[model samples]
Target: MAYPIVITPEKNNEHYQYLVFLPDFGAYCQANSIIEALRVAVKFIRDYALINELPPMKLKLPHSTGEQLVTFVNVNLAAKKGK
Candidate 1:
């Protein structure tokens, strides 16, 4: 089951770290760096699924909000990342 993992950096401190939330496992992690946090989150989710013997659940991608929010880069540069 593919799930959505939302990784949002804290607004007050950008470089401090990232806050990762895995809703499927109801688990969260705060790491000194983004990469480390992501790695832990994935490992936790995998272990949880295996131990619980829960079948994979299909995840529906969320839709973007209609509101136009301000972003750091222009659309062209953002598009290059394939959003």
Candidate 2:
């Protein structure tokens, strides 16, 4: 499944460059780049799905600023299980 994720650039933080939010799961992760953010988000969703029931995909996304980006990360749970 392809899950929606919101990536917002962090200005003050020195450790990370972006804040990634998984609205459906009400979870968040940090990364230094957009590519890394998506990677972390995908791993998080896969791990969360392994332990908990997946929530219904939200059609509406949370509010974001002009610099924030919204994108999708595709994950295949069935394939993950085989690993």
Candidate 3:
């Protein structure tokens, strides 16, 4: 199953970080880039799915706040240690 992940850039932090929110899991993952964040988010959801049922996601993506991004997390990916 695929999950919707919203990427929002962190501005208040000293170093730039991307915040990944998985709406279906009601979870978060942080990384330096969107791809990396989504990758992490995918792993998160997979782990969560193994434990509990996932929530139904919205058919439409979230509206961008001009500084944020909307993306889907594909759960099929195998994790690489350094990715």
Candidate 4:
């Protein structure tokens, strides 16, 4: 029941950096690589769960229209940590 997170490039000026946005949890972060972006997303999820008293993996946000088209990013903490 996890929500999809969106990742976007910094801008036309800088394509190497990226921003991660979690629409359901209302969290975001920036990183230089996809792996780093996932790490940031994982942290954001933890913080959000702790502060909001909601389980991170139990919330699924419905997809909605009227939003910018950005590719959704999948976060894998175990893979990133070499687990």
lDDT of 2: 0.90
Candidate 4 Cα RMSD (Å): 5.3
Name model 3 segments beyond 4 Å from true: 77-83
lDDT of 4 by residue, 1-83 (tens): 34567776676536458777887667777878777877677777655545576435534544544432343444444554568
Off by over 4 Å in 1: 11-16, 62-83
The estimated TM-scores of all candidates read: 0.53, 0.89, 0.77, 0.57
Backbone clashes counted, model 3: 0
Instruction: Give Cα-based local distance difference scores for all models.
Output: 0.52, 0.90, 0.74, 0.61
lDDT of 3 at 65: 80
Q: Model 1 clash pairs?
A: 1-56
Q: Cα miss at 25, model 1 (Å)?
A: 2.1
Better of 3 and 4 by lDDT: 3
Residue 4 lDDT in model 3? 75
Residue-level lDDT of model 2, residues 30-79, one tens digit each, is: 99999999999999999998789988775665677799999888888888
| Model 1 lowest lDDT segment of ten | 68-77
Model 3 TM-score, 2 decimals: 0.77
lDDT of 4 at 47: 56
lDDT, model 3, position 78: 42
The residue pairs that clash in candidate 4, if any, are none
Per-residue lDDT for 18-83 in model 3, tens only?
888877666778888777887788778777766687777665676678788887766652442224
Global Cα lDDT for candidate 3: 0.74
